[model samples]
Target: MSGGVVTRGRERRDQQNGQNSKTIEQKRDEEQVQHAEANSLALTMRSGLEAISKEIRDLKTEMKKDLTTLKEQVTEDVKSEINDLKREMYQQLSANTKTLQAQGSRIAEAEGRIAETETWNMEVKDALCKSLKQQQMLQDKLTDIEGRSRRNNIRIFGIPEDKEGDSAPKYLHQLLTTELSLPPNVNLQIQRAHRALAQKPNINSPPRSMIVHFLEFTVKEMVLKKAWQKKIVVEGRPLIFDHDYATEVVQKRKAYNGIKKLLKEKGIRFQTPLTKMRIPGTTDRSSTDPHKKQHAMPWQRVGERREGTARSAKEKLQEFERITQDSE
Candidate 1:
């Protein structure tokens, strides 16, 4: 019996060992299947990472292109601005140059005109001087001819400088003494040089113009006629003398007014001033003296005063007042 029991225990132990071996084999097979699935998932993750890297590279390239385009556009804009500024500078410089040139031209023209005007003024002065010199010579000849021919000669020469054109007559007087020395029989005397009636400026007193007076007479009839032969010059102008000049001019003046009348009528009216008196006049010819006798004015005879009273205006007033008071 003991033997049999020991055999059964041994059989039981062998069965338990076999079952444990089967269980271990099954567990190993399950582990191998799990590892294969895990490997497949890792492979999928690697592929997704590669796709993301490619997308990032494309984005970086697009950004670079945009930046290059923007830089080029900015450069073009700057170049345009510089060109505009250069154009404006050129225009301004050109305009300024034109303005300066115009101003220079005007200044040159003004200087030229001033030079011309000065030359013209010099010419005018020379012409006027020449004319005056010729006139002076003619006046001298006229004066010399009159002085040389006459011993007791009555002459009229040279209007006053302030009046017409006669100043000192220095040139004429010198010519007479040097160019045409007077004969021993002839006497040259300026009777009086006085102011004329057409008044002008004076140095010493009130303003007065001038008139020429002279003493002249012919030694013989031939000499007298020759002196006044034809040429009478006044103020550098020629004149003709007539015996009836005074009478004819007076009649013409009564008819009309002219420069001739002004020359003849504007001076002292008499050789000697007459006193304010009503006196009788008589001629030297005894036969004709009867008709030449003059009478006192009727108004002067009527208004003549007797031997005057001694009373003055004041005394007369007092006498008049006394008389009035007595009557009252």
Candidate 2:
């Protein structure tokens, strides 16, 4: 019985031991599952860290590139400012130099003008002194000439009669005393004759075909010469010169022509004649008889007996023939 009991205990002990072994194996499998879970969590955390590190490196690279670009921009801006400052400085310096140079030139010119003015004043003073002495001599010479000859009117020519502007009036008067107070046989007109010839409406003047006019004082040739030398008009058109007789003839001719033109315009009946005439009060030809009141001079040879005494056309022809025969 004791042996059987002992064997049963041994069996029970073995069975318990096998059950503990199975529990041990189950605990090991639980530990393995836990370890695998821990490993999976570590791998996931490592992958996240790697991704964050790459992002940080990329951000750092972009920041470095932007910083370099910003540095380059700042450098260019500073260089441009420096260049602008240099240009402004140079411009100011050049302007200052030019201003100084202009001031120097003005100063030099002012000094030169002052010197020239002083010289001119001295020359004017010398001329005035010399002119005063000459006036005394001229007075004496003039008195001697007056004593030698009787007071006579000398016909002078070649002086300006009409002009808008010529020599100063005072200067021209001075010329009359100095150049034209002449002796006999010497016409001061010779001095001005050449200029008149140059401007002779026949040919022309040189350098330019400027019509020059010489003043002709009525009768004093010496005074006229002085005036011509002192005063002359230079222009492109010709100057019209008229003598005393010529001007009178021209005035009469113009008056006659004007009367004729007025008569023609008013439609007056008048015979044309060699000399211009007027129509009675208007522009009539002059034909009148002194003996009769209502009578007019015979214009044509109307009566045969009247032809001998009266100034008819046939009588005028006979008179002209008699004069011609006498001349021959």
Number of the predicted model whose TM-score against the real structure is largest: 2
- Local accuracy of candidate 2 as per-residue lDDT tens digits, 1-328: 9999999999999999999999999999999988998898888889889889999999999999999999999999999999999999999999999999999999999999999766544444444434444785785466446422312222223333333134433333344455545454433231122122243342322321212223434334344445445533334333222222222233445656665687679987564322234344563234322343543234322223322232333344577799999999
Candidate 1, residues 64-162: lDDT per residue as tens digits? 888788888898989999999999988998998998899889989988999976654444444444445577677556644544433332233333244
TM-score each candidate. Answer: 0.26, 0.29
lDDT of 1 at 37: 72
Q: Which ranges of candidate 2 are over 4 A from the true structure?
A: 4-12, 99-328
The per-prediction CA RMSD against the true structure, in angstroms, equals: 29.5, 31.1
Candidate 1 local lDDT, residue 43: 72
The lDDT of each candidate is: 0.49, 0.52
lDDT for 107 in candidate 2 is: 91
How high is the lDDT of residue 132 in model 2?
49
